[model samples]
Target chain A: MIKNQFYVISLLVILSMILVACSGGDAGGTSESSGGSESEAVTLKFFHKWPEPEHMEFYEFAVQEYEKNHPNVTIEMEAVADEPYKDKIRVLMAANEVPDVYFSWAGEFSWKFARAGQALDITDAVMNTDWKDQVILSAVEPYKLDGKIYGVPMRINAKFMVYNKAMFEEYGISEPATWDEFLTACSTLKENGVVPLAFGDEFPWAASHYVGDFNAKLVGGDVRSADYLLTAPAEKLFTDPGYVEGLARFQTLVTAGCFNEGPNGISHSSARSSFIAGKAGMIYIELEEFVTVADGMGQDAFGFFQFPSGSGDEGDQKLLTGAPDGFMISASTEHPEEAMDFLKFITGPEMGKEYVKRLGIPSAAVGAVNDETALPIVVKGVESINTASGMALWLDTDINIKIVEVYLPGMQAILNGTKTPEELMQEVHDAAVQAQSELSQ
Target chain B: MKRKFLNQLTPYYFLLPSLILMSVFIYLPVVENFYYSLFRWSAIDTTLNYIGFENYTRIFTDDLVGLSLFNNTLYAVISVIFQVFIALVLAAMLEAHLVRPFFGTLFRNILFLPSVLAISVVGVTWQLIYRPDTGLINQVLRAVGLDTLTRTWLGEEGTAIYSIIAVSQWQWVGYCMILFIVAIQAIPEELFESARIDGANAVQQFFRITVPLVRETTLVMTTITVIGAFKVFDIIWVMTAGGPNHASEVLGNYLYRVAFRNDEMGYAAALATLLFVITFLLTFIQLWLGRTGKEN
Candidate 1:
């Protein structure tokens, strides 16, 4: 009888232990506090992608300042690095545990969130109010989807060919003004035993940046958007002859021995290092990376040029391959007002100035960067961004992710000499058809 | 009769907690995964369209699915050859008292050191060693005036999978060797003495005695190696991310790309189901073979 009683007691203990383990401990008891009055203490969970110390310093200052101004509101902040943050945010959204405010890329990345009703519609807060006037119009344009504002722009970024000034002077290579000149310069550098372009496609998104630029320039924005958004008919999706031509033009650079050998194996950072070390004469980099380049090769050692215009006059030659990264409020936030206030605060002129001063990137907030707050090259890059005909968002983020997956690998195949431009475009077209069907469903 | 019945009931009562925990955590998710595999859903989307077997059919038609399966098979086969067969041979050598007494422990420890390090650290270190221009391999090849023979070990499609597989072997061979060592040590010294008396040479004794004695360990090791090869993600993710155009893509990496990167949760779930079925069937076959061997 005693033994049987012992078994019962032990079983009960074990079961209770499991039950305790399985129970999710009160996640800060936020649910109860939610929907409370403005005077009541409320905690807003904030998430962003910049976890590196250099970026984190700015966020920490912004949060501290925001908290000081709103003592009743406690901000619980979390951050992850760029790549893993995408996966983490998706899981958070799926679990319906999205933070009050989170960082998001400006194109289809945020659009998918909007379509799912996860991103709050801030049309009134952004457009109806004076907030829209505070940011660069072009910077905020990508965040506006289907006539509704979904996100607030933070930093403006664009790609350019940053060249070594010394190497260019020695080789007598002036900033190329056309595709033919660019090709000639590449051959000249290659003949001189210098890597003409430092490129890496290990992450594949690096390849997508080049392709995005070429596609935007060759295929034009309207046609690319129609295919990217899957609004085009099945026969017309990604079937543009200019897309094939754009890919072929990219391939011409490859065949001319323009890029560093075994580029697919090298990482973007490594490629940047090669350019900084003067092993490569040029590198296609984003405006945000100017700080790193300036740090590595000295501010005076490099000069920037837009990728020279192609001979084909098919698309907007002045369209820059770039976008503004920004923050969005969760649609299901109980404290939409508080979240909006937080978004405005983080993306306001003060934080934007700090963003440029500390991060050396151009802020989307109007007049947030100048000679005093940012590097000379950053200021110049921003000027170019402001002057361009338009901005093309990063292809990997702008297009449906399924099609991007095919396009990325196909681009790598082209680099490896395994697939032709026409062949890859056919595969891309097929993927687009599939993506269109999936999107419709 | 009452006491026997109580005793039987007591064991079940003690097992109830574990059974419940497993049911909730493991069994429930697996069942739920199967149900999810039949739907079309994105991670963030609220809608779940019931598309019965469409994801499964898509899996059969996807070219990446075929390539990934082939890569996984290649990994498994190579792992079996190096981690199991070669490890067993090395263990026999170490146990046979062939090495100098002082060097035996030294060699074993040296070999086992890689397994002790974190896999991520191993991956990063190997990536540096395989780098194109400044890597250790290329530097050595260039130093030997064999520059033409030097290639980007982790970059080319022809070499990327093999390079990743080589890293796995470097890290795991020692672990398998240690396991075999333990198994070989368990056989009584008297048996070897008797075999020596019968004039059995070292090679003959290894084949005739040590191999037979360690059959159970070999089965366990092979099962582990094969399953582990199929589920390889971290090293590949850290090294090439199954890239140079998916040349090194295994089932695990493909599933993750579909689920997270592509945001096709249903399709990923279907891929997960296929992985589970393959591993399950392989394990069942292995266990059955072991049992039949025992019976014979």
Candidate 2:
């Protein structure tokens, strides 16, 4: 009896231990799966469309630095190409798998994502922060929708003419101050066998960008007001007298044979290359490209200038077409607090200044930015944004993206002479109205 | 009775997996896509309202849609006329008595190399070859002192579509060449020998013996090419992005833009439905042609 009882006790103890071991394993698995204490270490997935390794390395370095300072948080960065990144983000948004933090252009389409509640609300954090007062009002305001901040603005890019200084000097032509002078400059450049302006319409967005910047001179209006002014019923901005005049000016350039052969086929990189190589006289580039273009052309070749204003009847040059890059937090992020903390770290004065210094682009931060390669004229272009009475966001970025994807292609057709400008404008207005109704519905 | 039961069940058992796959991949999506076509939808729209036929009506009236369809048809017709006809002629030439002994195999393989490369690579390679400034074609033209003939091949609206088609033909003509070669080779040796014995020349034999033998291959190639031409997205998307103002726009790329970019899922689905109908009708016509020819 004693032996049998001892055997039974031994068997029971072994079985109990096995049960405990299995349950322990299950608990560990469950913990890991449920984002429990051990798995609670914050991981923020950050996505951007810029895939340059050097730029990404800086981002990676920042993430590591941020993590060293904040032990509980980590950031995973992914840089995807342009079209693919947009599609990936859209799919992720639909699937509720968006990254913790992602790059965004501050505009209507981007705002749609924020409005749909897919993005984390950072209004309180951004507004109440001491640094809020330091950020330029123009840059800071666009990221806020309906009085709620959705993203932190990174940089303010001013639209301007970026010329090859080497090419200009070689041709012995000074930078022009007025549209007429600009036209004459283009003619002079063309006469010298240099392509005047290297533009590509093959990518429909390029034409829209140029058109958007041209419209800035006419509207000279606030972006929000411009949006309401253009998209509101019975107010077709594409057909506005100002828009027509801009179109005519644009056409004069095209008709003068100012642009390179197959301008439509020339890509951004190639266009930049042409200007850099002294193959083209001019290209309209955003201010952010100042350092990048200099780096690409090795500082000796490239220069910047503001787009020459027209002498024709128009309001004082109140508005500059602009886009502010921003960062957003994903609503579905596993670590919202950590993501917000990362945003705070990057948007701070030190990082912003360093980024601006590295980029030669102006920052939206209230902090002083040191651009070591300071082309005074370029800095002047950047400073003009702060001095402008108002700013208009790029039309494609400001309006519903439906308008960009649909109507912009039509604009390309008008520019290509495949469709009449009137027809194109009419179709675009219809599309804009249709898009508004669709959005409202 | 047991043997009979096993025999009857054997066929179904063999077909069961494939049937399941078909239901999952093909039929299920067909049903779902059709249902999705009836509703207003978007990537993250929590609700999709049923708006019957509204999307379809919009697609029919859309000018861009019309342009896309016209371009797709144009591509198919041009590719068929040149790609198929030239492939047939080349196959006959290679299989002729003068070249057939050795050069036939060598030349066919040499011509078939382009079809082996990835479509995107082919598109990009041709894009460079047609580049306005630094491309090989223009360089050759300039070197030959024909600078006036040098123009932007893929950029101009006048030549973009044709240039694209030429690139596609360059890539796929090899595939058609192979198909035609096989068809020509399959003509019974007895028929050709008999024709030759009757004092028929090589060309006559080809016309009389090879052409009739290759009708089936022609039908098959036409069907495949037509389907492929309709579904072409990668070449155009990678090359021109249907641009210089939608000059090379095809139904496939246009459908993708409407659905993904514009977030008009319902309208895109409607467009897809029309595409499906067109493809189905053409396939039916091919089948009818194949059947009637066989019957006659």
Best by TM-score: 1
Across A1-441, the per-residue lDDT of candidate 1 in tens digits comes to: 888688778877887887777564564454545555888877889999999899989999999999999998899899999889978998898787999999999899999999989999998998788787788877878988898999998898999999999999998999998899999999999999999999977788899998888888888677888998999999999998889998998898889889887788888998999899999999999999999999998999999999974575678998889989999999988888999998888888888999899999888888899999998888999889888989888999999998988999888888888889999999999999989987876
Runs in model 2 lying further than 4 Å from the true structure = A1-33, A36-39, A69-74, A131-137, A220-231, A235-238, A312-318, A353-368, A372-381, B1-10, B133-151, B188-190, B284-296
Q: Write the residue-wise lDDT of candidate 2 on B1-296 in tens digits.
A: 76566557656654665676698788888778788899997775546889998888888688888889888998999889766888898888998877989798898988899989998899878877888888899999999999999877777777788889899898888889888998887777888788888999987987888887898888888887888889889899888888867778899999987777777778778888888888888899888888988886
**Tens-digit lDDT track for model 2 on A340-426?**
878877777666676666656676777545445345555677677778766667777677776677557766556555666566656
lDDT (Cα, 0-100) at B285 in candidate 1:
81
Clashing pairs in 1: none
**Which regions of candidate 1 are displaced past 4 Å?**
A1-35, B1-7, B190-200, B292-296
Strongest candidate by lDDT: 1
Total clashes in model 1, counting residue pairs 3 or more apart in sequence or in different chains: 0
Q: Report the number of the highest-DockQ candidate.
A: 1
